[model samples]
Target: MEARMPDPVAGPITEKSDHPRTEGDPQEDGDTPRRVVLADPRSYCAGVERAIEIVERLLRDRPGPIYVRKQIVHNSHVVADLESRGAEFVDELDEVPTGSTVVFSAHGVSPAVRAAAEQRRLEVVDATCPLVTKVHAEARRFTARGDTVVLIGHADHEEVEGTLGEAPETTVLVETPQDVARLEVADPEKVSYLTQTTLAVDETREVIEALRARFPALRGPGSEDICYATTNRQDAVAAVAQEADVVLVVGSANSSNSVRLTELAQRLGTPAHLVDSARDIDPDWVVGARTVAVTAGASAPPWLVEEVIDALADLGPAIVSEHSVATEDVLFALPREVREV
Candidate 1:
């Protein structure tokens, strides 16, 4: 069945449930039908697919080790699969031999990193998501205008780091409303803000509101900084969370978007867990849960979600239904270097 469009006027974000499930045993529950509701927009957004395909094309067409800086898309499974195909994951450009071909991760790199790669004379295949690239451009643009750029995101995230590197002297990182209260700009009248593409939409809105209250003349990106995939997945998961007894998000812990989905569900008053795969699902989390909503982070592969559904079925007779907030038809073109490949 097709998914209905998300409620445009969905209620404001709610606080986490006061009564969270603490302890339980799946086996202890009496005979009950278990239904798994899968979030339709879950798994592999256009940018992630594009990033992985870039590496796959490089491995298939290029010779020697295809060095990739950082986890290609933040999923261990995707990185492992690419590694099995002979892709070398490196922490920095220095790790790659000079003149070797290297691909940057989907998270855009800092100008400093780009300078480092250029210094090493490495053949570069940039896989940074176009959406992230947009933020980087905004950071540079705002700073060039003499506006202090307040980046709303986790301080240590690769995406944030890269954007900060755009204008380190002028860009400051703020993760919450309180951070905005403590922020001191050289000229509050000349302040602008940009956000990490993978941040939670509702929470980011609050942070932006805080910034506005502090700097009434503040400016923002021409468009929303949060990518469409992040917003769609969050909407789908929030809808499913309303009906689900427990919510399971599939993705690595370090995946910001994936973590946001789990956090969104929890905020909507459902017990949620972030799982890398079926193996990570704790039985206690779903022991008494009659309806489990399953969702994968944008970086997670589709097969992993299927595996999780199968594992849940193994626990008992199960019926699965998909709760989609919207259908995603977004596609990004491959980088020019590997486009012909």
Candidate 2:
């Protein structure tokens, strides 16, 4: 199913002016007034940016419709924009005609998928984020060394599915600490672990700890598999959540990092909700909440964040300011097929 996206250029919704409140209004609750603190480093990260660009570049240079398998990134606004610009998103290789070009989403694909593309003689552009590609390679390496690759990630996510396919027979998907407890492996002494890049930092840490307790000789990657963008966004939200009464994470439900942002805020004891856009906000959520923190998933665009702020400001004379700092220089290059075309 497709996600709903508002007009990208529209202004905030306003039904009526902010009217004077009655005695039972929030002002009588002895809570703080309305304000918004935006989390910096909140929107489009390097990997997501590169993936979108790959499709945009292809659409500009190629003829007819450029087929992309799955949403290039999880944000509906992004997919909608690309679709308007002549990109068609499909579910699988069979949906794409033989000899037609197909671009893999940032969420990688399996060897079998590659073979299918080869058989179809379809021109392929690999837009799989380098970070995700690293995890898949680690899985293969662990399997080659005769170790059971214990993957810590969501079982149903596209990225996890691709990583598991790399070493399906040897890799066991562990979604929770409980999963680790119930895990069965061929050899206890020979085991390794990798993680989905978009998992909650605290969640993954607990899972890893559980894994280590079970497998004393468990080998981890030289670097953590959780992508830098995911960690940074979660860190920003955690810091902001402490000072806010409510938090709003703007992203599609399928966006893993987006869901993690909301969970992190809730874990910090703040009321948080994941939303597709500012239109999804509930007025009751902000009642008696002095301050609200705003953040977007890495795949989300800045425009959606602004819309939330606009809606909040319309709710009252809300004061808005940024509460975090981010210096991001990381970037991934576009796939070669699009570049050479």
Choose the strongest candidate by lDDT.
1
Candidate 1 clashes between residue pairs 3 or more apart in a chain or in different chains: none
Residues 215-329 of candidate 1: C-alpha lDDT, one tens digit per residue: 9999999989998889989988988899889999999999999999999999999999999999997777877678898899999999998888778867765667666667667
Enumerate residue pairs that collide in model 2: none
lDDT of each: 0.88, 0.85
Best by TM-score: 1
Residue 146 lDDT (model 1): 100
Question: Which window of 10 residues has the lowest lDDT sum in candidate 2?
Answer: 1-10
Residue 333, model 1, lDDT: 85
TM per prediction = 0.92, 0.90
In model 1, state the lDDT of residue 18.
31
Clashes of each: 0, 0
